[model samples]
Target: MRMSIGRRLSLLIASQLILAALGIMTSIVAFRRLTHETAYLRHYVFEPFVVISSGIESSNALFDLLARPSSDVAYDARRPMMELRSFVEQYQRDWLTATSTLPEALHLRAALDRAGELGLLNEELAAVDTIAAVVASLERTTGLVGPAPTAPFLRRADVEDLGAALAKLNKINLRYMDVAYSAYDRNRRLILLAFLSVCLAGVAAASLFGLAVHRAIVPRVRRMVTAVQRFRELGTYEPLGDWGNDELAVLAHTLNTSFKAIAERDKDRDRFLAVAAHELKTPLTTMKGFSQVALNQRHDAAVRDRALAIIDRQATRLARLVQDLLWCARISGGERPFNPQAIDVQELARRVIGEIEPVASDHSIRLMPRGDAHILGDPELLEQALWSLLVQAVSVALEHEPVLMTIDADSAGRELITIEVRGGKDLPEDLDRLLEPFAVIAFEGRRGEPRGTGIGLHLVQGIARLHGARFSIERRPGDIMVFSLELRR
Candidate 1:
């Protein structure tokens, strides 16, 4: 589905935020696990070992008192025996409690089972109690304790046995510590691996997403910018393709549309200038030629008079061209003011025919009025339009082919004024293009080059538009062409 630019950006941002949130949640969970591991080691591993070590130290002291006792050592051994018993009891309670919390510590659990099988903590407590009983017996007064108990009460063998038992349990505790520490290390490593995995996955996902976003948006934006830059430098550009139904695509479409219009208008302006130059050059050439003749042939009054008249005629033609050009400019710029009034259609048609009659002596000009007609229009502009249309007709009409002008109402009995001029000559193959400015239809003339400014029909079209009239052209085989102008009455 096509998403708009705003929605797409929002989705991208939302995705990034979701990824970040996931990363943060992973971190929090990892940290929680790390904290739990820390507590597990303290309670299950380190603290239990502390209690076991203290018990072992006290047991060694107890063994010393029993094996070789001076009076001072004997007095101190009493305190050590009490401490050994208390330490052993504490170690037993804590070890069992700590083991319950660390179910996943496989080696630690195994070592705990081994300690229990060895009768480990029980043997240590038993030895401490037995030696206390022997010491109690040695201290009693039986006729002053039967010669002050000269031999050591507990034998070296018994002491050795107690030490061996203590040593065995110590070994078990050491093994348990090793297993617990290893478990802790593995736990740390697992947590670290998990954290790193989450981070790597998040980073990779973000990278892929970033690349996708860049591909979707950046290249399209770059293309539009490049197109605009090229247009700026050269006043021309190729259109951008539709990337999607996004804002940037719409922008690209709008720019292409505007540039196309500007290019077409530029083309029309160039064509107009060329045609205008040609029209001006022809009249200026004729005026220059006749003026020179009048100046050089001063002695001949007849020749000078004829040259002046010809010059005056050409000058008038140039003036009319200027007026038409100005009117075209005003209409195009929307500066031409409209003033409509009731006008006699027949009178205007007759005026156009009379004006063209002088130069159109070779071809007959006729006007057929079906009924008297009137229309609301700008009289001057309407008359100028009709004049241009008649002249254009006269230029293409064969000498023997009469140019006909008609004024009448259309089919619905609705009042309409129409002027139709037909010529024996054929129009250009592209009839529609012929309406464009500077478009001239090539037709052979019996005289010199056919007199056409190429601006007449274009100017006529503009004038028709200003008066809200319709202009059309029809042609038949053998180049029998007809031009029609329809106006509402």
Candidate 2:
């Protein structure tokens, strides 16, 4: 059967559409995933900076508290105070340079504040010890412990006030530390939540996209591959199904059309080769053999007559090939010359069956015809078609098993007839090619069996085309092979 151009085009369009849709889908999925990943990475980088800034704020408070004398400690307040200042200064510089993501660092900008309550209490402890020592010195020298020398009114009121001020600084540090840690903890959770959401979204989207791709696109592409394989190995054309109206579908359709067309063209080439070979083989064999025999023998009258007879037979074979070639050319050139007449297809099959019955019996084959069918077609051409089929059936039948040809009308007087031709159980893998002319299985240097020019079926195909019918060959179980002929008027 001929595949129409419009159908081919639809298939092509469908294939391209399928491919394009899949490409677009993949790009979308990749882009989304990349964007989400980038955001996740950026969030990860900013978390460290917030942590370091909080450390700098705590160190500065300790430095200021040591600068004052507290009348409490035996240690030298001046030297300790200088060391504290140096440490605070170093820490302050570290704060300016530290690379931390902690939010508290951004919030706590000011520096060099006064000492806290702990510093004041420590200063008081130093001053009290110093006073006790001073009183002891006076008692030892002057036998009096009455509040050492001058600055006497500098009393405990001084230490108490300094302690109160220090307490306030400690409270400030505690408050800011609480705020900073709280912000960091909350922000950390927020970042964690964001990342989790992004990851989940990416996973979900990937799965959805994968499902879409497998469901809508992969099978269509796989079908194109299967179709190609079947065409190459089996000489069969299978149409690619819809992948949807999407780009992938279009691609699948287009590829299917290409594969089918390619298979058909290949089949045509094989057919032409087989038919041409088979048809040419017979006449060449006869002509060569007769000419060589005649040349080798003395030309006696009887021998001459026999030579002429053989030559004539070969000439007839040549004529048949030439006629087939011409007929094929005409058909190709659109010279379809089948004029429909009211005729019975069943009658034609019966007639052809009768003509070939003796041939079938000679081969020990059974040829049966059964059906009630009428068709508006060229009876001569149609009969020839049936005859050609029966001849091949008898050729393939074995010595003992009878070949059976069954014909039955299909549905509503539609003139549907199936000729089930039974023959050898073993069929050639290249069965269709076998129908061609000189493609017979000949010995290396001799004439082959089933002698005839192979144009018989070529003629049948051309005539069927002229009548706008469809012809196909298929195999059945055992030794049965069937030819399906659909004739429509």
Candidate 3:
């Protein structure tokens, strides 16, 4: 099947939308993971390590008090000062190497400087030498009375300066951690929101695609199939039913056009058959009459009787053929007029069965009335449809074939009448077309069967419709053709 452009575009759009949805989902997950990692790196890693750097700096004052580079204090001080330098270097190196990005190294540098300026370095050598003089005075107290601690040289002012600088650096590092977490949280939320929006859009688009695909494909195929079935069974139908202006619409238009052309051509053919049947009927009747007159004067009894029988049989067959043709023409012309009325159902069934009684008896087929019923329709047309059904049934049942014909009406006092005709020999599968005026289908029959082209049922159906009746068919073991007249009341 050739897909419509709208369907192709919808598919393309749907595929793109699905991909976009997946992309959004991936982004949301990745962003969330990144944000979580950033939080961990800031608080668990950077924040803790920054505080470690501050601790490493604060420990420096102990080393400063021990470091006297001149006399006796140098030996004791050098060991402690060297240990402090190793500790600071190790912690700072760990902090620096653990992460390459972010401001850890910068914070470490500022922390080291603050630790140094806090009476641990000379202002003469940028505070280092001042710390040296204090260390020398404390270490060289060989003869001080009461050991007065060699006059304290590490001043409170130096400690205060280091403390203030450390506080400022710690605050800055705390702020950096806070900002990093805040930005991560914001970006994570953004990705999550975008994912939700994309999901909603995808769902809506999928629903629309489903509806559009259904509308574009299924109904047109159904309509065309239905029309063809009706045309095959009833020989005619209006095929340009309900459809839009898409390809489906174009298909319906083409179907209606083809059927219209077929009907027109059929009409022309029926006209010709009518003229031809009439022309043949006159000569056959005349020849039968002249031959019978000569048979009446014959002295040879056997010869004359055979000729007379042949003439009579030929004349009857010719008349029946002409009548069938005439009926087809009248039906095709839509000219089967009848008076409509509210009819008693029981009486209508009796009347139809009564009309077919002679033929049924002749063919040895039984006509059974099932129940009494009423309908609002033309009694004449209703009887005709039933009578046609019975006639077809009897004709088929003549070879000792058992048959059943039934009639009834629906409930609710709706005046809906029904007629069903059944035969012993299973009916032809295409028997539904038997009622179609110009649509003749052949069925197997016994020898000496009456010549017919399957037009009687067609005429009955046409007349029934002319008076507001519903025609329906069911093919069972034997064909069941039915007609129902809807109550006017």
Give the candidate number with the greatest lDDT: 1
- Model 1, residue 233: what's the lDDT? 92
User: What number of clashing residue pairs does each candidate have, in the order they appear?
Assistant: 0, 61, 14
Give Cα-based local distance difference scores for all models. Answer: 0.67, 0.52, 0.53
RMSD of 1: 9.4
Q: What is candidate 3's lDDT per residue for 60-120, written digit by digit as tens?
A: 6443553533354434344544443443444344433223344644433343344443222
- For model 2, how does the per-residue alpha-carbon lDDT over 1-489 read when each residue is reduced to its tens digit? 333334445555555565556555655765574554444333422332342233223223223434555453322223333332343343233332123233333333221122122343344334333433432342322222344443222223333333343344334444444444454455556555655655565556556555555555566667777877887788777777664565766677788778766766566567557756665776788788887777777457678678767777667546645765666567657775766798876566667666555434454434344455566887766766777666555555545445555555656554544555455454457667555433442212123443433455566666777887777667778657776667774
Each prediction's RMSD to truth = 9.4, 17.3, 14.7
The parts of candidate 2 lying over 4 Å away from their true place are 1-271, 291-329, 342-375, 399-421, 424-462, 465-472, 484-489
Report model 1's TM-score to 2 decimal places. Answer: 0.55
Per-model TM-score on C-alpha atoms: 0.55, 0.36, 0.38
Ranking by lDDT: 1, 3, 2
- 230-348 in candidate 1: lDDT tens per residue? 98899886978775677877888898898897777677667667656766898799899989999999999999999987777677678877887787678768898889999888888
Best by TM-score: 1
* lDDT of candidate 3 at residue 69, scale 0 to 100: 35
Error of 1 at 226 (Å): 6.8
